[model samples]
Target: MGRKAIYTRVYNQLRYEILSGEIAIGSPLPPERKLAEQLGVSRNTIVRAYSELEAEGFIVSRMGSGRYVEALHPAPSHAQTHWGKQASGKLAAAPSHMAELLSVTDTYPNTINFAHGDGGKHTLESSCFSDYVKSTAEQLHSYYFTSVQGLPELRERLVAWMDMEPISSPEQVVITSGSQEGLYLITSLLARPGDLVVTEMPTYFGSLQLFQSLGVQIIPVPMDANGMRIDVLEGILARYRPRFLYTVPTYHNPTGWTMSLDRRKKLLALSERYQLPIVEDDAYRHLHLDAEPPPSLKSMDRTGNVIYLNTFSKLLFPGLRVGWVAANRSFARLLTRMKELSITTNTLGQLALAAYLRDDALRPHLQEVRKQYAEQAAIMAGHLDRFRPLGIRYERPAGGFYFWVSLPEEINPRQLMTECLQQGVSFTCGDMFLLREAEQPYIRLCFTHERTDQIDRGMKIIDHVLQSRKELLS
Candidate 1:
């Protein structure tokens, strides 16, 4: 065989091993001469093959050490062939932090996890969810693909479920795998690289991750008690012509500050005046612990400017991976086409969700969840309030799972996280949510997952940590 053919053969074998997990990531490859001898090829052939793997991002070479498989796999090379550069970029830039957050730390006995967003002990019945999938598969019996816009009945059900002022039509609703996919679709289609996208300060980190991957510039507008400051947003609008504004107005993540109705209206007016599109992410709107949240921006929108994204992930179950985007008829149609091209929605799951929604099962379930979360939130707030005199501050969120807490300026947030983990407690670092590094110390805790008793214990652990730090300083 030709020398080129020999190297190609060796390269393909190495690539297959890496992709198939036979060659674990970060494991060193055999030395060039050793590998060449084993494969009955020249050292030059091994060198060329290694270079090929490195170029494609499957492996890397260290200065003194041998070649090692990359820890993070590159996007499938076939993505550009099938979809385009956008698809490739999306897959390649999948956030590393998400993987860290999703790891199976559950195996660690006695570890109190507050890092994840999902229902901790309150997660839905797996057997029932399996039944939904099985029943739908057996009964529905459609060998063909479902509509890209989503199963028709599901779209209709979602529109009725949300019950916005303007009343969305079935045609205006496009189903997505989840809110993450919806955000990705919007970001990919609406704005290109170098375009500006404005977001609230300390906005959803997931959104920030997507924006950064897309090469879109994110301008953060500071938030207050009401929500994203309209005055600050106006200043940004005047100076920079951003392509769109993204906000989690109701039951804001991390901080849990719901936007006041007045601010919502002002935001709508600003969007109208600026002719800027608003991507309103109301993922946690239904998880309201106390009163209902203010009218959604999409509901308040007179023009076809607000693209509303909602998910059942936080409320019902995230594993089902079902969500929807509501927009004007034309844009929604465009999104449907995009969905069709980007790995069509899960047919069986959508049908099951539709059946669940149609039977009016979600409301009763939400009522129970609301009560539980409310109790948990109060317990968490009470503990923090006890530590209030120590300069630790937080807003008692009206509704939502997270408590965004600020520690005393003297304590380092990273150091505090390490200490908390050592004490068998884990929480999200607040800087993960921000577009830039923040000056003061902040952290996010999800109270929804832990049992109230466990939460109390965890809070006491945290309090002890704070008190110890204070003592050291004195």
Candidate 2:
């Protein structure tokens, strides 16, 4: 056989052994002359094979010692494939802080988990959700396929209740599996790789992760209580041409700060001037504890720039993964096509929610939920006085599931999280929501998921941990 063929054969064998774990990492490979003699090949063939392995990062050569296995694998040669080397990076990059963020930190004792946005728990008080599901299921039409836009009945129902005035026609809506899919569709389609997009700093981590996975650059604008700083956004728009701007305007996630009406007007003005499209995620809009939130961007928009995304899951059913996008006729049609390409439709969820809405059951049920959440928010807030003494400051959220609390820089948020978890308590650390994970002096607390008593218990535990952390400092 040719010398090239002999070296190539040796290279393949070594590569297989390293990848299969037979050649353990850090173990020394046989010396070149020894390996050549054992395999009945020339020393030059062994040298060539070892060079191949070293270049691929499967092994490393150390002077005076010998070549040792450095890695079983190297960076993917095919970024397109989705297996061993084929798959995992795109999905794996999502929510890297899931253990600390999602409250699945493997604590043995019963944990008061505050990591997830449990819209599911809030709906336990719901009365007629099951009835509508049963009724809708009994009908054969509910089982049949609907339009790419969604069921006409469902779209019509959404139009009637949508806070936005732009949704005057069913043709202007596209039903998605959930608002999350709406985000994915919008971001993936509008912003290609290497393109820039704008987002609020400490915004939804899901969007941050999605953008990073897609190789999209995020221009994070810091927000105040009034919402996305229009002044900063104005500068960003002037400087960099982003594909779109994403905001959770009403009763925002992580931090329950709503955008003021004045800021909303200014934002729309900017959008009009620059012709930038806005993707407004209004998931928590219906959870207002007191007066209704200011008019949504879509509602205030005169120009067809705002693409409104909302979900029914948070309303009265968490498992009900039905959501819709309200946009201009042109954008709506494009989103409909995107939906068709991604997820066809959630027919059963749409049918059930539509039937429930048709009966006008949502309004009363929402009021009850608002009251329940308000009470829960208060219960959690009542404990804040205890936390304030420990360098922990938090604003009592008027609506939404979270209280974006600020901890002291002196204290590490992850350490606090670790101590809390050891004591059967769990909450999201602040850094999880940032574009870059660091020791951020903020933590997000959810009050709507647990019962009032559980919420109270969790707070006491957190307070105790904070006190301990503070005492240690002194």
Candidate 3:
């Protein structure tokens, strides 16, 4: 065959081997001359084929050393059907109630969605993320699959970025598709059917979804302004012997409460007493408005009981879908294997994130986000305070982008949500975050996505609805 045909043949062969995991991650490919001799093709054909593979993110080259099979390939066991029956039985059921609530889109015509946690600033020029993307494109030729635990260099840099001492080794960290995936992996590995999983009442809706999917019995404990009620948690732990207690101790999702330092200590004490693992979800930990963020539970754990899950979706951009888990080495290994069975995350995205983390641009960008979110949150809170009727109550959040508003007993938030949607304002009903069917006339309003004018307009419409209802009552 001609050189062109030969090149195509060699390229496809390498591609299949890489995808099938016959060539392991980080393994070196034969030199161009050696490969040419083995295939009985010219060195130029081998070089061309290798070049094509490299360009498509299938391989990486070291300056002096030969090209290596990029770690971008899927793990060897993904194609195996051995786990299919188990997975089918486990995941066949529909998602939990909270999951269904999260899936509901707020894209009604003319409606303003204050429901999402994302920033509303969509202009490419306004986002510092554009810089990360530009930098990633520049290094596209060299990008490759990161280690299962993620790139060591990126983890090391993350250590510095998070203001913590470096981990002893990279093997203790497992890079996940997102914090959601990290939670799922941890729950699947540590929890069994009928095992009790503890969490704050009205905790992150996504965590409830994960635990439900794994068939774990949820034990919801109540929380006050200081965060999860440690006294109540102690009593529950003594009774239930839960496998793990999941929490967002800082800037909690729906309540927007931060745990006090004393409560944090008490939580660690409870962990020690019960020997229950703490799955600390720090998804919003970085979006602090007032001061430097609190030390992560993983960082504070001396007995190795805390499994920390963090993500880039809040601090950086949501679309990246990159996060990591810091846990004991044993658990990390199981998570890595589990990830192999699941669909591998986007290799290109991981590489770009690694580059972004390494570029030292995150700190200033985060500072800008914190400032903007703080301003926007304050604006929304002011409008709510001024417009909301006497029966409504809300606590100003210390950090993060959400405000949980508790409405009057007379007003049904579910019905109000529907009416508000008609008025072009959208927010999540509070029942969406609860585990049981307990009713609370509340809703979560996110101030991050809308402009000041939009927030003002939305609140005015909601007030109009409330006033109109009051007039009918009179």
Query: Could you give candidate 2's per-residue lDDT for residues 394-458 as a string of tens digits?
Result: 87766888999999757888898888888988788776776554445788888887878888999
Model 2 score (lDDT): 0.78
Residue 82, model 2: lDDT of 41
lDDT of 1 by residue, 171-273 (tens): 9898898999999999888998767888777777888778877777666666777888787677667766889999999878878888888988888898899
Best by TM-score: 2
Question: Model 1 clash pairs?
Answer: none
Cα-based RMSD of the predictions, in order?
A: 15.2, 14.4, 23.5
Which number leads on lDDT?
A: 1
- Full-model lDDT for every candidate: 0.79, 0.78, 0.74
Q: What is the TM-score of each candidate against the true structure?
A: 0.78, 0.80, 0.77
For candidate 1, the clash count comes to 0
Candidate 2 residue 319 Cα shift, in angstroms, is: 2.3
Residue-level error in angstroms, candidate 2, position 350:
1.0
Candidate scoring better on lDDT of 2 and 3: 2
